[model samples]
Target: MFSIVGGHPALDLANTVAPRPPGAVEEEYLPDPEALVRWARLAGVIEADEPAEPSAAALADVLALRALIDPVLAGQQLDVLLRRWAAAIERSRLIPGPHGSATLHLGTDPALVIGDRLANALIDLVRNADLSRLRTCPLADGGCGWLFLDRSRNNSRRWCSMDDCGTHAKSRRLTERRRSRR
Candidate 1:
């Protein structure tokens, strides 16, 4: 999700319209907390303890979004975002806008840069997107972390040729189990 949403354009979008942080907070690096909350939806994870002091309304808005993305947040109303970061194996051939604004895709070569967000957007166009359209994959050359493609079967490709998440999750559990047994 970080690899997907942290692109320049998304960062710009988050920065462009997001509200300002209050007090002695550093404003340069992080944008408004609300925008950050929305962007987190792309990958369906959000962080906690932003530098800003958001209004009760802002906090509520962020919570609403969190509930939409993650059912777990239904109760916690997250104060901090925590997620497992798996090593990226393959990348997508995804592309962002033709607009050359302050987005991450701005400097990327027109021939390059494609991924899941585009897939989500494209799938959004069909009115009723089949859940299959949401599937994202990755390349083999250690290029992208995840990718998405346009296909009718959507079975067009596997999400991860290397199965990074599965392998990592298994490894993590194995280590934990070994320690527990010991």
Candidate 2:
């Protein structure tokens, strides 16, 4: 999903973002502004040597916030689109993970739980900001879903992986040509 990440560091400190898999448990949370204000307080939760499951009451508020990403699923994951990075680094590449789940961490240890924590922070970023000017991303998390990021240029950047989409589109064209010749 297109995650948005930008703000004046109040509740926008989404330092560790993570990619969600299809079957991953929902953390029993949704995400809401009011609850985010409260949820952000739990930033320390992920930081704990062994954090507890976020308060059930808080988890209820979080999960009730925005459980799905919209039309394709539930709703436009407003936070997903807004949870992007501020760095202008071009061409993001995938990093290997220990469990065979490719990961892209904003930190030295990609598998660390903090990455997910950072992503949650970015979620709060979008949840609290004005999104009238954000640009829509077609695919991210390897086509898991869509996301929205603030584009400084007029160019449209959808998926995070150009290698896959760019290369696959070309491959499809070649295959179609071979089949047509038969």
Structural similarity to truth (TM-score) of each candidate? 0.24, 0.33
Candidate 2 per-residue lDDT over residues 13-129, each given as its tens digit: 321122233324333223433444344444442332543333455444333323333221233655443442222112234688788878653323223233344444445444664
Q: Provide C-alpha RMSD values for all models, in order.
A: 16.3, 15.2
Give the runs in model 2 whose Cα sits over 4 Å from its true position: 1-60, 68-144, 150-154, 163-170
Q: After superposition, how far is residue 96 of candidate 1 from its true place, in Å?
A: 28
CA lDDT, every model vs. true structure:
0.32, 0.38
Candidate 1 global CA lDDT score = 0.32
